[model samples]
Target chain A: MRPAAAPKAIVALSAAVAAPVHAHLVETGFGAFYDGIAHVAVTPADLIVVVALALLAGQRGTRAARYAVFALPVAWLAGGMIGARWPSAAALPLLTTLSFALAGALVALNAKVRDVGVAALAITAGVLHGLVNGATMAPAGAGALALGGAVSAIFFLTAILSAEVTALPVGWPRIVVRVAGSWIAATGLLMLGWLARSAP
Target chain B: MKTQMKRWKQYAALGAAMLVLAPATALAHREAGQAAGFLSGLAHPVSGLDHVVAMIAVGLWGAVLGPPAIWVLPVAFPVVMALGGLMGLLGFPLPGVEIGIAVSAIVLGAMVLAQLRPPLWVAAALVAFFAIFHGHAHGRELPEGTSALLYSLGFVIATGLLHLVGILLGEAHRWSAGRQTVRAAGGGVALAGLFFLWRAVA
Candidate 1:
């Protein structure tokens, strides 16, 4: 009876130690939220689109800026919800690439777009981006991911908006912004080619 | 108090020893089998300093050349590289392949440092020539029993992405200070190339 009791105690102690290790392997709650933020930060294609869109909105002035700050996040969340429900959309990457290309080109041209047009672009960009994000995010972490993504998007937009309003320099600095637009466009085009080549 | 200090010193020494031994113990077990397939191929170019620097130099040179060169060099490289890869797969000998790769970094980095704008064709040819060595190295490393097509796709995409990063950095040439910055980066690449060259020879 004593020997059997000792074995049982050892087994219980081992189980207690292993439980936390297993929990660490499967991230939940705030860990998942941080994962979502990291996911967006690491994706170059996603980052280029966000920066280009924000820059374009800012270039179109305060009204467009105001519309983008509000519209993009709301539309992104809506799109994420749609994607979570139906995850099999094969066209999201291509659509995302195309939208990014168009946005970059528009920015490079410094096109004068209306506030309504900016809002429309914002919605399209947000939805496409959120769809991709949602498709990749694990089901168990969907809520956390959405929260993190929304927070990141807001942070990025606010930063870009501030730069556009206050810090963007004149002459060469302005040209640098345009050049960045071109680079973004080039990246999009390259990715498009890559996808086409890799397509089964 | 003296005894406590001695005890703390002993603990510190033990902790330092553990820190030194930690990395060796962690890396003691290498998985026995070769990693095969697309993921392995994708990882190959990134794993080698020689491959990464040369590929990036190609993009930097292209961006320095501007316009058609920017587009043309990148396009020409993989096509020519595929030919080299074929040679490698066929077991055709290319001697000093590692040396050639290191030299590519040197020459290409020098070109960037000097802001040399060779004719578009010349630039394309230079990149294509170096690409062969890089591609052959990759092709030779294709793991046994892996799908060649998938492996080729993986390396090509990885190589292209590296070129894109270089191009983005090269775009710094749009500003005056940016031009200086890019040249400074070129100098750094050249120094790195020299180091790799030294290692290859030694």
Candidate 2:
């Protein structure tokens, strides 16, 4: 079916976005700490998402999903240009939130959600995850691409893995996704609290 | 099997081609206000950790947001941001500009974590204000005697690509097991914003 095409498209996109990102991340003056976190923690997760999405959607969804995934990096470029030229407070955050939330929503809508409650939870968790990552970029050179690429890779991989198990028993899929969402939500809460306390 | 391998080779070639063309166009710089020069303006975002993280993150988030949001939000950012940059170059003083930019990181992070649903105008206003600081940076840093068109083009293209990174990452949350990991990563970014806030004031 059409859903099967998602994963393939994501993989293709990953390949396209990764090259420049890699060069940019490697160029960071901050040394290897941020790079290591991005590459190890973030990138693998992104790649896994692609694999899961591909598995779930199979061959049919590839074209659409591929383009969908490919569009992320392109949007990154455009956003950078905006910030470079304008650099306003309100516009920056607004664009940042909308962009990340929309992408997460797209993936959720395309895939099957066994329960509406769980789906909402998953979506909310996804937004939290995306927001935090968006708030902390390297700012200069091609570093944005590099950092963004690392995070993108993580989500792509996750999509791939989710897609892989699409055919598993329905209950099983929901349970797995729910559990993951719970952990993510908890982490977000922790970060939120920490940030609030730390802020003056 | 032979056919599969052949297809793989073709894909590989395409990938290679994309890689070659990627660097020049694929990279993004910070919106450094209305700098008078080329390299300095371009170098603004790269100079500070705060601007770099939030700018790229905005692009990445746009990528995650899906098609219309991705396209509209990213498009709106640069267009508006450029306006903000113009204001800065003209010596329009925005009070608490630095603090506001830092606050944008905090607020944006909370919005993502909270999944707040605000009106479209709200989003526009938030981005518009933040763009001023970013634009100012560019204006202050841009090299003198550079073609404004070329400099703008260079930065705009780079900025869009940054949003693409966020979109892809946000989309990654769809995977089964990886959802938590992605969320955790987002949380990490928010935490980093806290660090930047401290740095800005210190």
lDDT of 2 at A170: 52
lDDT of 2 by residue, B35-100 (tens): 433344345556676666566555444434444454445555654555555555555677766776
Task: Please give the range of 10 consecutive residues that has the lowest summed lDDT in model 1 chain B.
Answer: B25-34
TM-score of chain B of each: 0.79, 0.68
lDDT of 2 by residue, A1-200 (tens): 23345446645675656534312333346554456244424232222223322332321243433433443333333443444344342123323323322333333333453233323333333333333233334333334544455445544654555444444555535433332332222212222222233345
Model 2 stretches astray by more than 4 angstroms = A1-200, B1-43, B63-67, B117-119
Candidate 1 CAPRI grade = incorrect
Task: Please estimate how well model 1 matches the true structure, expressed as its whole-model Cα lDDT.
Answer: 0.67
Top-scoring candidate (TM-score): 1
Q: Give residue B110's lDDT in candidate 1 (0 to 100).
A: 88
How does each model score on lDDT? Answer: 0.67, 0.45
- For model 1, the stretches where C-alpha displacement exceeds 4 angstroms are A1-29, A144-155, A158-167, B1-202
TM-score of chain B of 1: 0.79
Residue pairs with clashing backbones, model 1: none
